[model samples]
Target: MKIIEKMNIEKLNVIYQIFNEKDLLRKLSHQGIIKLHNFFQDENYVYLVTELANRGDLGFLIKNVSPLAINKSMIQFIIAELLMPLEYLHSIGVSHRDLKPENVFVTEEGHLKL
Candidate 1:
């Protein structure tokens, strides 16, 4: 497909995966990071609307790990920040079941909140 067509298909696929409103909410809520905006179905299709984070996931950052010198505190901060999602999910009775360096994400504020 052309680039534009491929992009549209991706968006549609995201919408189709939800199955329904309830499923979408449960799934997105469990994403541990991104904020879902809305999910709906109209006649022949389902749609999922969510806040788009251009920075991408933790997997990307980990793959691009920097070689520059860093302090121990920085490492500790990264670990804690990434673990917060796992902690919050578990507290809510949800287990990520797939916790790993790839499943984390760092937001733009340098807060490592995700």
Candidate 2:
């Protein structure tokens, strides 16, 4: 779950980005994108409940594993999997600005999620 402190909402741009992300997540329903299960705001913070990516982000994987351990086929598969969601987002007139290894997650079953 993502917890955004209400204190940060006083910053107009931060609030805008937060709500914008929520809106984008709400509209997206592709397999490659992270799933947003629920959202709610309390007096102190706003909560976004999402699916758990048990394997963690790609950045973590890359940082800990040996470079030789990641084969060509795996790299190709990850790229292909990433492209599907990018295509889907583009088709819906949405552009993801901050896409990096840290933002890409791996599911328990080894599937990718953006």
Candidate 3:
């Protein structure tokens, strides 16, 4: 999937810093975090080509599906799946500054990626 992040020219330096740290970004790949495949920029936006989450994000999915629709096993699975990457990030002194259901995605295979 492709995502475009827009920022003012003043924030250009921030984007460059992020892109320049490709090794750090690659090291962050895990079960729960979205993998960064490639990145580029034009005049106004930074383009990221990343893995596709066919099931979309967790926030919108929860809105459309009732909580009761999910069984005990599924809840347990999601919690278990999310924990590893969360722990791994923290262990490496990284904090997910923006963590919300919107930032978590579900794969077609019933797994979660943050």
Candidate 4:
């Protein structure tokens, strides 16, 4: 779960914008760009329930893994897997402004998930 606190006006505005973009978020989930399960709002905070990526984000793995162990075939596979979701998003007129290793999640089955 992700929590957003409403302590300042700027934060509030950003939260409002996120809430306003629910349609796009849902579409992203359908396209495998994100795993948004559900969202809720209340007087104090906004809660987001999403996929549990037990293997954590790509950045953490990259930082810890040995460079020599990442062979050519593995690199190709990761790129190819990531590209499908990106292409789908582009075809639907959506762009992920924050595409980075930290945003990509890995699954326990050794698969990459957006």
Provide the RMSD of all predictions against the true structure, rounded to 1 decimal. Answer: 6.4, 1.8, 2.9, 2.6
Clashing pairs in 3: 32-114
Q: Estimate TM-scores for all models.
A: 0.53, 0.87, 0.77, 0.78
lDDT comparing candidate 1 with the true structure: 0.53
Clashing pairs in 2: none
What is the C-alpha lDDT profile of model 4 across 1-114, one tens digit per residue?
557776653555675566755557665754345577898878877777777778888889988899997889989988987898888878888787778998888877777777
Which consecutive 10 residues in model 2 have the weakest lDDT in total? 8-17
- lDDT, each prediction: 0.53, 0.90, 0.75, 0.75
lDDT of model 4 at position 97:
79
RMSD of 2: 1.8
List, residue by residue over 15-102, the lDDT tens digit for candidate 1. 3433443353445453345565665555554455555545556667656768463558778987777677667766767555556655
TM-score of 1: 0.53
- In model 4, the Cα lDDT at residue 114 comes to 72
Candidate that beats the other on lDDT, 2 or 3, i.e. the better one = 2
Tell me, by TM-score, which candidate is best. Answer: 2
lDDT of 3 by residue, 29-87 (tens): 67777787887777776666668898988888878887797789867887888888889
Q: How close is candidate 2 to the true structure, as a TM-score?
A: 0.87
Ranking by TM-score: 2, 4, 3, 1
- Residue 66 of model 3, lDDT score: 79
Residue range 1-113, candidate 2, lDDT tens digits: 77888887776558878888998898899999999989999999999888999898999988988989899998999899999999999998988899999989989998989
Q: Where in model 1 is the C-alpha error above 4 Å?
A: 1-32, 40-48, 69-71
